[model samples]
Target: MADFKELSRLLEEILEQGPAGCGCAVARNGEILFEEYHGVKDLESGEPITADSVYRQYSTTKVAVCTGAMMLLERGKFLLNDPIYEYFPEWKDTMVAQPEEDGSYRVRPAKRPILIRDCFSMAMGIGYGGTDYTHQAAEKVRAQLRANVGEYTLQQEIKAMAEVPVAFDPGTHWLYGFGHELVAGLIEVVSGKGVGQFLKEELFEPLDMKNTGYHYFGDIRERMVTTYLLKEDGSREASPYFQRDELFEPEAKYEGGGAGLFSTVRDYLALTQMLACGGEYQGRKIMGRKTIDLMRCNQLNEQQLKEFRNPYLEGYGYGCGVRTLMDPSAGVNSSVGEFGWTGMLGSYVSIDPAEKLSLVYMHNLFPNREAYIHPRIRNIVYGVL
Candidate 1:
C-alpha cells in the first residue's frame, strides 16, 4: 500500500499549483490506491468534480485505440508488416512530398505503399495541419473536412483524408495524430463493425468500462467536465461541451481516433493496470503476455529515435501506444522503461514497469499553462516508490 497522507498532500499541492478544477488517480497492480478530485466540473455551474467526472482524454485515446488494434493483432487478424493499403485500398499508390517551383514541396506519387506498422509509428499522413509541408497537405483536407457542412460518415472523412498526400514515406519518421485514426478505420474494416461498436464489443464491455466511450451520453453526460484553455495572461477559457444532439455534424463527426474519447481517472487507471499486469486484469486477458511485450518494446532505430524526440518527449522511442526510451540524466526524473502518453488537454498516464507502478493525472484544461505539474507529480510518485 502507498502512504495515503503523503499522496494526498502531493495532490493538494498539485491542485494548489494549478487551477482548482482537476482530477487525478494512481493505481498499482490493478488496484486504485489513491484518487482525488478538486474544484468544479463545470465552472459556470459550479459542479464539483468527482471520482466519476469524465474529461476529454485527447491523445490519451491513442492508448485505447492502439490496445484495440493490438488485441486484433494477437488474434492474428493482421500482421504489423502488412501494407496498410491492403486493408484500405484507397491508400495504395498515394502521393509523396516533392518541392514545387517556388521551393515549397507539393504532393506527388509515393514510391512505396504505407504499411500496417506505419500506422502504429504515426507515420501515416495525418497530422496537426500546421504550417509544414505535411500539414500543408493536411490543411487542404482539413478545409474539405470543414466544408462538408452536414452530417458526414466516418468513411467520408477518411476518404477525404486519403485524397491528401502523405508528409513523408511511411516508416521514415514519427508524426503524431493520424496513425491512430487510420488504425481505428482499419479496426472497422477488419472487424466488420463501426469503430465505436467494435471498441464496445471488444474492450469497453469486456473490461466493464461502463463509463467510458467515444462520446458522452445519459448520466455520463452529466458527469462530463467542461474543457478549458489557459491563456497567455494565465486566465482560463472554457471549451464548448460536446452535445449528443449535435454529434455526427461536420465539426463533431471528425471523431479523431488519435485525440478523441472522454474518460474518468478510475476508468483510465483500469486500462494502465491491464497493461502493467502484462495484458491481464481480474483474470481477463485482453492481450497475451507476448503481445504486451511486443507493444512495450522499442520499435524505432537510433536515427528514427532522434526524429521522434521533441520538447515534450526527449530520449523516447515509440512503442505501440506509449513512449519507451529512458535516459535518467535527460533531466525529466521519470523512470527508465516507463511507458505512457499524455493528452493535449493536460492529461498524463505513465506505467513504470520497472517499479510496478502507474500514475494517471487528468485535467480538462487546455493550453496547460503551468506545465511543471506533470513532471513534479511524476517525481513525487517516483520518490514515494
Candidate 2:
C-alpha cells in the first residue's frame, strides 16, 4: 500500500489555490490504492463532495470516446489507414491550405487524402481554434449549434466542418482540432447507431459506469458539482449555472466526445482502470489487450512531435486521442509509455500499463491550471509508491 499523505496535501493545495471542491482516486490492477475528496461541492451551501458527485468531464471524455471507437476497430469495422471520405463521402479528396508571403493561406490539393488514422491521431488538420480557414470551418458549425440549440446535431456540425479546406495535408502535421468529431462520426456510421447510444450499450453499461454519459439523468442534476472561476487574487468565483438536457435526451446541441460527457470520479476511474488493466473490468473484457496497446502507441512522427508542443505535455507523444510519455527525462517523474489526457476543467487521467497503475483527478476550474496542478498531482501520486 502506498502512503497517500502527499496526495492529501495536494487536495489541500488545490483548495487553497484552485477549485473549490475536488476529488482524486488512484487504482492499480483493479484495486484502489488511494481515493480521497475534499472541500465543498457548493461553497454557498457547504455541501461536501462525495462519491456521487458528478462533473463535466470536458476533454477527459476523449479517452472513453477513443476507447469506444477502438472497440469497433477490434471488431474489424474499419481500418485506421482507410480514408474517412470513404464513409462520409464529402471528406474525400479534401483541399489543404497553403501559406503565402502575405501572411494569408491559399487552398491547394492534398498530397494524400485524410485517413481514419489521421482523425484518431488528431492529424486530420481540422483546427479547433484559430482565426484562419480552419476556424471559419469549425466556427460555422458552432454558430449553427448556437443558432439552433437543442435541434442541431453533431452529424450536422461535423458535416459542416467537412465542407471546408483542411489546415494541412492529412498526416503531414499535428494539430489538436476537431478530429474526434470524425472519429465519433465514423462510429455512428459503422455501428449504425448514435455515438452516445453505442457507447452506452458497449462501453458504459458493460463497465457499470452508471453516472457517465453525454447527458444527465435521474438525480444527477442534484448531485452535480459546481465549477468555479479562479481569479488572480487567489479568490474563486462560482461560474454560471449551465443548462443540461433531461435523461435520454438527444445531444443535438453539444459537441460529442471530448467536449461532451458528464461523469463522476468513480465512473471515470472505471474507464482508466479498464484501459490500464488490459481492457478488462472485473470479469468482463471491454477491449482486447493488444487493442489497448495499439491505442496508446505513439502515432506522431518527427515533425509532428515539434507541432504537439503543449506546455504540460513537454515530454509526451501524441497517440490516438491521448498523450503517451515518450521522454521520461522531460516528464514529471512519470514512467515511459504512461498515457492519458486532461479535461478543460482540470480533470486528468494518467495510466501506466507497466505497473497496471492509473490515477483519476477531478476538479471544477476553468483555465484548468494543468501546468501547476497536474504535474504536482501526478508526481505526488508516484512519490509514495
Candidate 3:
C-alpha cells in the first residue's frame, strides 16, 4: 500500500512553497484511496480550496477532446487514414514552409493530405502561437492566433490554420500544436453538435461529472480558484493574462479543444477512473476496452519520438492526445502503459493500467507549472504502493 501520510506531506511541501492552492486524489480499481486539499482558493477572499473548486484545465482539455474523437472513431464516422479535407476542404491546399537561403521561407504543397490519426498522434504539422520558434510557417500561424485569441469561432480557427503554412508534412513529424483543436472541429462535423454539448451528452452526463464544462455557471463562479505565477525570486502574483474575470465569457467563441475547459479534481478523477477501468465507470460504458487500450499504447515511431522535444515529456510518446510511458526508467517512476497529460497550468492526470491506479493533481497557477510536482507525486504514490 502507498503511504497516504507521506504522500500528503509531499504535496504539503509543494503547497508550502506558495502556489495559490491544490486538490489531489489517488484511486485504485475505481475506489478513492487518498485525497486531500490544501491552501486557499483565492488569496484575496481567503476562501479555502474544496473538492468542488473549479480549475482552469488548460492543455489537459486535450485528453477530454481526444476522448470524444475516439468515441467518434468507434462509431465508424470516419477511418483514421481518411483525408480530413472532406470535412474542411480549405485544408486541401495547405502548404509546408520551406526555408530559403535569404532568411525567408517558401510555401510548398504538402506531400500528402492530413490523416485523421495525425491529429490523435500529434503528428499533424499544425502549431500554435506558443511555438513560433519551431518554424517560420508556424510563426505566422501563431501570430494570427495570438492576435485573435477570443475573436474566432472554432470553424474560423480551423479555416485560419489552413491559411497558415505548416512546419512539415502531416504524419512526417511530431508537433503538438492545434491538432486537438482540429479534432474538436472534426467531432463537430461528424456529431453535428458543439464540442461542449457532445462531451456533456456523451461523457459528463453519463460519468456524473457535474463540475466539468467549457464554461462556469451559478455558484461555480464563486468556487473558481484564482491562478497565479511564481516568479524566479519566489514571489507570487496573479497571472495577468488568465484572470478569473476574463474567464467569465458570455459565450465561448472558441471552444478550443486543445486548451479550454474548467473542471474539479473529483470530476477529473471520475474521468480518469473511467480510463483506468478501460472505458467504463460505474457500469456506464464511455468507450470500448480496446479503444482505451489503443490510447494507452504508444502511437509514435522512433523518428516521431526523437522529434518530440519537451523537457516534461522527455521520456514520453504521443498517443491519442495523451503521453504514453515509452520508457519506464526515463519517466517519473511511471510504469509502462501509464497514460495521461498535464495542463499548461499545474494540473496532471495519469492512469496506470498496470497498477490499476489513477492519479490527479490540480492547482491554479499560470507561470508556475511546478515542474517537479508530477514526478514527485508519481514517485510518492508508487513508493508507497
**Reference-based lDDT, each prediction:** 0.74, 0.84, 0.82
Encode model 3's per-residue lDDT on 1-385: one tens digit a residue. 5577888887778876657789999998888998999888988888999898888898888889888888888999988888889889988886887667886676789899888888878887866554332354455664677687745678876876677777778888887777888899999999999898899999988989898887767677778888888877877787757654454465646687888888999998999999888888987878997988887677788889988746777778888889988777665686888899888788899888777789999997766555678887888888877
Tens digit per residue, CA lDDT, model 1, 188-239: 8888887777878888877778877776566876677777666677666675
> Model 2 Cα RMSD, Å?
2.3
TM-score comparison, 1 vs 2, better candidate: 2
Q: Alpha-carbon error at 348 in model 2, in Å?
A: 0.2
Task: Indicate the worst ten consecutive residues by lDDT in candidate 2.
Answer: 242-251
Model 1 — TM-score against the truth? 0.90
Look at candidate 2 and give me any clashing residue pairs: none
Q: Could you give me the TM-score of model 2 versus the true structure?
A: 0.94
Kindly list the per-residue Cα lDDT of model 2 for residues 147-253, writing each as its tens digit.
Answer: 87645666776666676788888998998878998888888999999888899999899989999877657887788888888778988788764323332254344
Clashes of each: 1, 0, 1
Give me the displacement of residue 342 in model 1, in angstroms: 0.9
